[model samples]
Target: MEPNATTNENLNLYEKAENYTKTSLELLKLKTVCSVADVVSTLTSKIAVGVVVAFFTLFLNIGISLWVGKELGEYYYGFFIMALFYLIVAIVIHKTHHKLIKTPIGNTIISSILKEKQN
Candidate 1:
């Protein structure tokens, strides 16, 4: 009877440990899903905004380029000026992209993933 009681106790302990492990794994999975969803949603919204802004800028530039060409008496002159301006801007961005773009974007993603839920 004593041996039987001890065996039953051990079995109960094992079952409790198994339950704990399964619960822990489920919690981990939930947290992972939450973090991924947060990151994806944040990125999706930003991309949408970026697309809208890009279209607006495209039309604005085209209008400005045409206007400038009209004023300059040659349509291509306005485009050339705009192209030169963009070339310079691109060169500057290329030089500082790591500092101005990459680090900030990386930090934003990391923060989104690590940010705790409010509720």
Candidate 2:
């Protein structure tokens, strides 16, 4: 082939490669945006549920405290007992922080991303 022909072929090949790269990059960006959106949605729902559950637990605790006080005939002692129970729970949660909180959260995020990819 002529030198000019070879140069033209090389240019065509380079153009193809550049087009391929652009397409790949666009696909990557789309996937990343989708993944981020999924994560944000999941977190939003989880946070909402957490807030609702927190309110429920608060009222439940208060009710139990009042009941305990009524049974024992000392109003504030029930509250103290409820507080002690919470303290113990807090300590247990603190000790198992990774097992109870971190791992599950990480797994949830990872699974959400992976699930998005699968779909």
User: Each candidate: how many clashes?
Assistant: 0, 0
In angstroms, the error of model 2 at 64 is 0.9
Where is the poorest 10-residue window by lDDT in model 1?
A: 110-119
TM-score of 2: 0.90
Cα lDDT tens digits, model 2, 1-119, are 69999999999999999999999999989999999998998799989999999999999999999999989999798899999999999999999999999999999889988886687
lDDT on C-alpha atoms for all candidate structures: 0.92, 0.94
Where in model 1 is the C-alpha error above 4 Å?
117-119
Across 81-114, the per-residue lDDT of candidate 1 in tens digits comes to: 9999899999999999999999999999877777
Best by TM-score: 1
In model 1, the Cα lDDT at residue 18 comes to: 100
Q: State residue 73's C-alpha deviation in candidate 1, in Å.
A: 0.9
Give the runs in model 2 whose Cα sits over 4 Å from its true position. Answer: 116-119
